[model samples]
Target: MSRDGTSASRNAPLVGTLLVLGYCVINSTKSVFEGSLVQHLSPEFIAFNSFVLAQGFYFMICRDKAALLATVRRCLPDVIALNVATMVSWVAVLYAFTVFEPAMANSVILGLVPSITIALGFKLRPGVRALRLEVVAALGMLAAMSFLVAAAWNGSSAIGDLPKDDLAAGLIYCVLTSFALSAITYFTRRLGDQGMSVQQMMASRFGVLILVTLGLLIGRDSFDAYTPRNIGAILLISIVGVIVSLYLLQAGMVRTEPITVSMLFGTNLIITYVVQFLDPRLHQSTTTFVGVLVLSAAMCLGAWARWRDGRDNPPAGVPDKVPAEVPAEAEGTTQNVGNRT
Candidate 1:
């Protein structure tokens, strides 16, 4: 290789790491934005509008319309499953945000996603096994969640007092969010394994969700919620949260190791807490802060575990070049729309 080419190859991982970091920072703010939007616009309206905007964006940038249609047709069942899972997860998290403080909701609820995904993976894939460190990390994150729970129970939450019934309901919604997100992740990986590109998946994943949210808006008579300000907010979030962040993640994962991507994403908890701290409407209690720290650590540990496993079991040989038909799963990039929160 030429010297410049060699230099570029060496720097690719660094560039990818920076891109993923940018994604983490951008994605971390999603909950805060959605929380604010939900207070003015119904969750259904926000969801409906966001999905519509995102769908348009994806369609514009989609490179191979024919390939996307063919993939959807070939994997019609999986596409439907993915859409249902994304809808449930999206709506559940939005409802949870309405009940819990945005940052707190992110920490206490969305924080459980990795662990839940692990559990789901174990159950769904019989031959798969989790690393010891992953199990420990999952348990640690669960334990850390208790501190936030305790704060809420004692009426000492950082976001101010929440009603007990609402808190209970929010917890239930959180559970639903976690499970649905895990399912979405699982379906995303399965589709990737079956030859769907990330763009193809994103382009087709929201059909059911759009229909459901539209029905909800009609039933609630929420057309009035689409004021100029609300519309602007939806557009901004769709551009920043859905389109830009996913693009960065996809580009970064293509060049970086999966472990590095995982580790960078783990920092999202801290970034989210910091964003919440800056927002005048939200506050972080000491216990909740500590819990966030622990959860972040747990996430890092889990990433390390996965990395170690891969290292210990390297592929038998490196290919000179990737096969043309290899899917995104083989390339170490998978769609994860759940981060849009």
Candidate 2:
């Protein structure tokens, strides 16, 4: 790692953009499936089935068992924490969906991810400090998120309004989801520091979630409620959302700062709104339009931060300690985690 405590690859900006875009798309699609599937299935069942299926997919493609074993051994605590955090985030989000509007839930919870990730990164790796420009960018991003949520509440009633009965539970679950996701981001970076590949992390995480699911299923009648449609939805979500989305996330986080990665995920709100706008049946109010403008300005600030990083070699005052040329995959002996498939 550099003196700045970042393991960022040379192509971090390019790779991170692609990874975030792909993740946003997958998450948007997953919301669709969850909307349909959650009606007939319990959150535990959906989570369990998705992880089990995703683990199976990983097993079918995973190679370098010895290296994987070593990585797991070296990072057992991080791995366990990652798994626990991941499950909690998903379960909370699933339940939040039941009690709140999709936009409302994401607006409240997802904004916390980037801020919490920055705090966690600083705590875990003492040398990691946000550049002044990056701090400004992060605050802009948060402001944009607040604008979007306020828009949801004030305008486009269909996009943001929630029932009074479910408000307390929804807020609680959203808070849980946010904190858990932040923890997941921290552990992901820790695991990356231990030289674990994306595939290895995915395999270990889903494998652990599966085990937890089985433990929850003990003496329960949960499996009896499965239907072919819901089962198909689970398979789709497992493949696209769990397997593909997380793989991109793990791969990207290895080459990017965890806080930056989480910040990039904030784009999911824009993506979700865009998806809704494309649907002919829905109509957004004037407030949504103004919110989009504010969010776009936030994105411009974020883009400026990335541009500043790329153009200013020494980052204004910091000494040039990072290697001029480092192999992107030098973190571990098992180089290409994505190669097996």
Please give the CA lDDT of all the candidate structures.
Answer: 0.75, 0.60
Clashing pairs in 2: none
lDDT of 1 by residue, 206-287 (tens): 8898999999888978765556888788888788888898788777777777777777876776787777776676776777
Residue 204's lDDT within candidate 1 is 87
For 169-283, candidate 2 gives per-residue lDDT tens digits of 8767877887786676556667766667666876677666677677766646566456787777788888887778866655555555433544465555556656655534345
**Candidate 2 ranges beyond 4 A from true positions:** 1-23, 144-156, 159-161, 214-224, 246-267, 277-300, 314-341
- For every candidate structure, what is the RMSD over all alpha carbons to the true structure, in angstroms? 2.9, 7.9
| Angstrom error at residue 321, model 1 | 9.1
lDDT of 1: 0.75
Q: What are the TM-scores, per candidate, against the unseen true structure? A: 0.91, 0.72
Candidate 1 wrong stretches, greater than 4 Å: 317-341
